[model samples]
Target: MSGWKEIILLEEKGISVDEFVSGFETPNKLILLEGCLDKWPTLKKLDRDYLVEVCGDNRFAVGPAQMTLTDYFVYSDQAQEERPLYLFDPKFANKRPDYRWIIIGPAGSGSSFHIDPNSTLAWNAVVKGSKKWVLFPPDVVPPGVYLSSNGAEVACPVSITEWFMNFYESTKTWKKKPIECVCKAGEVIFVPNGWWHLVINLEDSIAIRQNFVNRRNL
Candidate 1:
């Protein structure tokens, strides 16, 4: 599609923090680093039982929906035939006392197109399963994507499935391509400020993500 660019991927090796700041200055190009967060113990094993044991009754935010870990497990069991609700809990930060962690259930759970708040750059570390991310640059809006008046939400009338069905055809003749990536377990994705992104879980996915601004970007 138009307004999309191929995201760059780098293996975790001798790359330094300065190198990242220098390479990703455009705020449009996405950088994927594999094995970046493999050292985190939390990523070693992530499942319903593990989360419930670790989180207990902690509540998670799933866009407009909210539920506790205990309650979510019960809901998932009864709603096996339906799409699992995408749950992103900031409370997970309590474990590491660091950034927030967002949890999404089996295939079909994910977020729609939207921009991050405060123009902050972000990084998402996928601990388990896989996620498909479609990202558009700040200035280039994808075809058929509508925004709210204040630009905080996706105001389109169609559902994400319907948007996907017709998005390609709508942008077939465009010049820019939306940067896209399939982030797998043990990988981290760096998203620049102002990019519009939509993430769909390809399986039961567990991830820790945070947005921040430093002297480099400020």
Candidate 2:
């Protein structure tokens, strides 16, 4: 990757809210905050068994179909597809109002390029395993991605793995190369509104992601 660059990383304790606001407002860049969720109970308690015990019976959207957590786990364990089904439930906030999602997926499972809806900023925190992220700025549409005239819909490669195989290298020669990083457990990645991003799990993973509107982005 010729122009490859890493997103800025900061220790959570070292940056004040005011400082973060200032930097975030001026540059509006993606940032990786380390130890941001160290004190969250989910970091220590969230796992497949815990999730199954609490929400096992609740069905979640997995690709084109819905399945319970217990069933999804069984499917994921043996899934050998190029793009495995990922558990992404939008209605999770109804059960736990504080968060928007409890994402779970096996290795090689992930989302394709797309922007967050409603132009909201988001933060994704990995609780178990790790994820690799590739992001392009709002002005740059990622390679192999197509958007409708009204931007209401997106068309991209069939799978994350396919995109990487066919398009990832092209980004390297781009003047505005994508920001890339591997976010591990206990770390958080702040995605600015309108950034085009794709995420792939490095291994069987569990994560919490929330989208929000703040004064700067609202």
Candidate 3:
């Protein structure tokens, strides 16, 4: 990565919520927050086995089919597909409308370049393992990503790994490069509205993400 600049890093204790709000109001940049979730019980207690013990009977939609956590874990462990199945339960939205998701996936699974819907800002907190993030600002559409004229749809490489293999290097030489970081367990990444981002798990990972509309972005 040529112009490989890391996103701004902040220690959770060093920044107050008011300070964060003030900075978020103006910068429109990504921030990697370290130790933000260090005290969360989930950070210490949640993992595949724990989830299997608690929610194994619950089925979640994976692609076109519904699968229980136990079954999903079995599949993920043996899956040889280029893009492994990831657990992103849509039903969670209906249950807790404010909290967006609980994501669980294997090492090779991830989301390709895309922006959040409705221009809502988002924060993704990692509970276990690590994830590599590549983010481009709203004005800088990623090289391989194509948006339809009406801006309602997008086309890109079939998988996240494919994008990195083919187009990741091209970004390095650009004058305005994307923000990059490897977010680890107990950390959070704040994404401003309309920013395009891609995320790939570096290991089997678990995370919670929420999208919200606040006064600043309203």
lDDT (Cα atoms) of all candidates against the true structure: 0.73, 0.86, 0.84
Estimate, for each residue in 1-218, the C-alpha lDDT of model 2 and write its tens digit: 22234455788888998887778744677788998988887788998888899999889988789898899999999999987899988787656444488789999999999998887888899999999999999999998999899989899956898888889888889988888888899999988899999999999999989888888766
Backbone clash tally (model 2): 0
Best by lDDT: 2
lDDT of 2 at 105: 96
TM-score of 3: 0.93
Residue pairs whose backbone atoms clash in candidate 3: none
| CA displacement after TM-score superposition, residue 31 of candidate 2 (Å) | 0.3
Over 4 Å off, model 1:
1-6, 25-28, 77-84, 94-99, 148-154
Better of 1 and 2 by lDDT: 2
Residue-level lDDT of model 1, residues 1-218, one tens digit each, is 23333555677775777787776744345788887876877677676678788885777876578788788767755655433577777665555533556666667777777787776788898888899888877887766777778866765555556668878565556666666678999998888888888888887777778877756567
Per-prediction CA RMSD (Å): 3.3, 2.3, 1.9
Off by over 4 Å in 3: 1-6, 93-99
Candidate No. with top TM-score: 3
lDDT of 1 at 123: 87
What lDDT does candidate 1 reach at residue 103?
68
TM-score to true structure, per model? 0.84, 0.92, 0.93
Candidates in descending TM-score order: 3, 2, 1
